[model samples]
Target: MPTITTTDGTEIFYKDWGTGQPVVFSHGWPLNGDAWDNQLKLVADNGLRGIAHDRRGHGRSTQTYVGNHMDTYADDLAALIEKLDLRDIILVGHSTGGGEVARYLGRHGSERVAKAVLLGAVPPIMLQSDTNPEGTPLEAFDGIRNGVLADRSQFYKDLSVAFYGANREGSNISDGTREAFWLWSMQVGVAAAYDCVKQFSESDFHDDLAKIDVPVLVVHGDDDQIVPIAAAALKTAEIVKDATLKVYEGAPHGIVGSSYEQRFNADLLAFAKS
Candidate 1:
C-alpha cells in the first residue's frame, strides 16, 4: 500500500490515479478510501488526479489509540496534501468526510484548494438542540455508539439499510452494495469507530463553513435518513459564502451507490471543471 507517515507516525494509506488537477477525497465513517472508488475512477478518467486515503484506524491505515477526533482527522488531511505537493486541489468529502473538509479549510486555510464538494455530509452540526430543531436526536447517536461498542458486525450490516435507503419501497439498492458497506466497516478499529461516533455527531462546523473561501458544491438527498438534508447540506450551503446546494430528490444518504453513481459522477465532473 502506498502510504505517508504523519508527524505522529501514523501510516496513512492512499490511492492516487490519473493526472492533471488534483481531486482529493475524504470518505465517511468506518469506511475508508475505498468508499470513494466510484468518484475516484470517474475523476481519473476525466483527466484529473484522484486521490483518496484510508484515514488512520480505518482500512489499510494503522489503527490509532489516540487522536480520533475531528481536529486530528483534518490535520491528517492537511499533512497528505502538503506531502504530495498538490495545489489548486478540489476537496470532495462524503458523510463524516464532509466535516473533515470544512474543518480543514477553517483550521488550515484553502491556500491550495480550488473547490470543495460535500455529498450527504454532516456539517453545521448534527446534534439536535434548542437552536437547531431539525437536527438528529441525541438518542440516535447514543444508539450508534452502543451498536459499535456492543456488536459492530451486525450493527453495520443493519445500518446499511438506511445508509443507502435500501429499506425504501421500490428501492433498487443491491445486496452487494449493502454487503460492501458492512465489509468496509468491519475493517475499522473498534476503538476508533467508537470515538468517531462523537466526532461526527457533536462537532460543530459553523465556523468552518464560514471560513471556506473556495467554491463549494453541497449535495444531499432530501430523503437522507442519516444526515437530514435540512440540518446538514442545507444549513452548510447557507453558511458558506460560495456554496452551491444541490438536493437529490427522493435520494438517500449514500448517493455514491450504484443507483446514483452516474449522476453523482457527472455532477462532480462538471463542478470540478467549473
Candidate 2:
C-alpha cells in the first residue's frame, strides 16, 4: 500500500511493481487503480515497471469533497512522478484519466514522457457546446448524475451494460464482471463522484491535447456507447502531432476488459517497445 503525498498534502495511493522502464496507468472514473491489475501482471512479466495510482476520492485515496477537478487530478499525478523522479515514462490513461494525462503533460511535461496511450479517453471535450458542437450533450451527463444521485446501486448496475456493451446482441454478461463493476463504483466517494461528473463531462482538454508532443497511441472501440469514438479518438488524433489511432470493431467503452483486453494490452506493450 505505497502512497505519495500530493502538493496539496493529499495522500494518493499508488502501486509500483516490477523493474524496468515505468509505465504509469491512470484509470477511468469510478474505478480504482486495480482496474489495471491485468495490465500490471502482463507488463511485469514482460520486464516493465507497471505502476497504477488511484486518484483522490477514488479507491484508497482520501475522499475529500473538493479538488476533484481535472487540474487537481493532473497536479496529483505530476507530484507523484516528481517525487519518484521518474523519467522516460510511458503514461497510459483510460476514460477520464486520459484527460488527466493530457492536462499533466500540458502543465508539467519536461521531456520525461516518452510515449502516451489514450484508451476510450475523455479529451478535447466530452460535452457538446458552442466550440464543441459534435461532443456529447449536457443532458446526457445530467441523466447520469440524476441516476447516480437517486439510486447509486441500481444506477451502477444499469451502467454496466453500456460500459461493456453487455446489452448488445451476442454480448455475454458475467456475474463476476458485473460485481467487479459494482465494487469499483462503490469504492469511489459519492460526493466526489457526483461533483466529478462535471469534471469528466464538461471539462475541455483542447489545449492539453494540442500540447502533447510525445508519440501517442489512441485505442478506441467503434461501438463505445459511453464516449463516442469519433468525438474522442478521431478528434484526439487530429490534435496530437504524433499520434496513431486504432479502432476495435463492436468493442464497448470497457474494451480493456472486454474480449479485446488482451489485444489492447498487446498493442500497448508494442507501442511501449517501439
Candidate 3:
C-alpha cells in the first residue's frame, strides 16, 4: 500500500512499477488506480515507469468530506509528482482523469511533462453553454447524482453495462470485466462520487486545454455514450494545438482496461516512445 499524503492531509494510494521514462496515469470517475492496471503493466513491460494514484475518497485513498473538485484533484497530483521527484513524464488520463490532466497542466504548467494523452476524456467542457450548444445537458448529470444518492450500488452496477458497452450490439465485453467495473465504482465514497458528477460534467476546461503546449494525443471511441465525441474529444482536439486525434471505431468508453486493451496499450507505448 504505497501512498502519499496531500497538503490537505488526505492519503492517496498509488501504484508505481518498473523504471525508465515515466508515465503517470489518472483514472476516470468512481474508479481507482486499478483501472490503469493493464496500461501500467504494458508500459512496465516496455521498460517505462508507470504510476497511478487513487484519487482522494476513491479506492484505498482517504474518504474526505470536502475538496473533491478539479482544482484540488490537480493539486493532489502535483503533490504526488513533486514528492516522488519525477521528471520527463508522460501524463495519461482517462474520462474524468483527462480533465484532471488538462487542469493540472493549466494550473501547474508543463515544465515536467513531456507529453499527454486523453482517452475517452471529458474536456473543453461537457455541459451545454451559450457558446457550446452541443454539450450534454445538466439533467443528465443531475440524474446521475440522484441515482448515486438513491441506490449507489445498483447505480454503479447498471452504469457498468453502458461503461463497457455491454449492451451495445456486437459487443463482447466479458462478465468479469463488467463486474470489475461495478466493484471499482462501489469502492468510491458516495459523497466524492456525487460531487464528481458535477466536477466532470460542469467544470469547463477551455482554458485548461489552451494551456497544454506539449504533444497531446486525444483518443475517443466514436461510439462513446458516456461522453459523446461531438462535445468531448472532438472539441478537445480542436482546442489543444498540435493535438493528434485517434478515433476508435466501434470502441466503447472503457477502452483502456477492457476489450481494446491491447490496441490501446500499443498506441500508448508508441506515443511514449515517439
Ranking by lDDT: 1, 3, 2
Candidate number with greatest lDDT = 1
Any idea how many clashes model 2 has? 0
lDDT of 1 by residue, 31-139 (tens): 9999888778888899999999998899999899898999999999999999999999999999999999999999999999999999999999999999999999999
Question: Which structure among the candidates has the greatest TM-score?
Answer: 1
**Residue 222 lDDT in candidate 3:** 87
Write candidate 3's Cα lDDT for 230-258 as tens digits: 99999998999879999988788896434
The TM-score measured for candidate 2 stands at 0.97
| Shift of residue 239 alpha carbon in model 3, Å | 1.2
lDDT of 3: 0.91
How much is 211 displaced in model 1, in angstroms? 0.6
- Looking at model 2, report the run of 10 residues with the lowest lDDT sum: 254-263
What Cα-based lDDT does every candidate model obtain? 0.92, 0.89, 0.91
> Which candidate model has the greater TM-score, 2 or 3?
3
Comparing 1 and 3 by TM-score, which wins? 1
Per-residue alpha-carbon lDDT of candidate 2 for residues 1-274, written as tens digits (9 for 90 to 100): 7999876778999998898999999999889999999998888989999999999999999887889888999999988898888989999999998989999999887478999999999998889877777789989999989988899989998898899888889888687887898899988889888988999888888898888889999999999999998788999999999999999888998844455897898898899899
Residue pairs whose backbone atoms clash in candidate 1: none
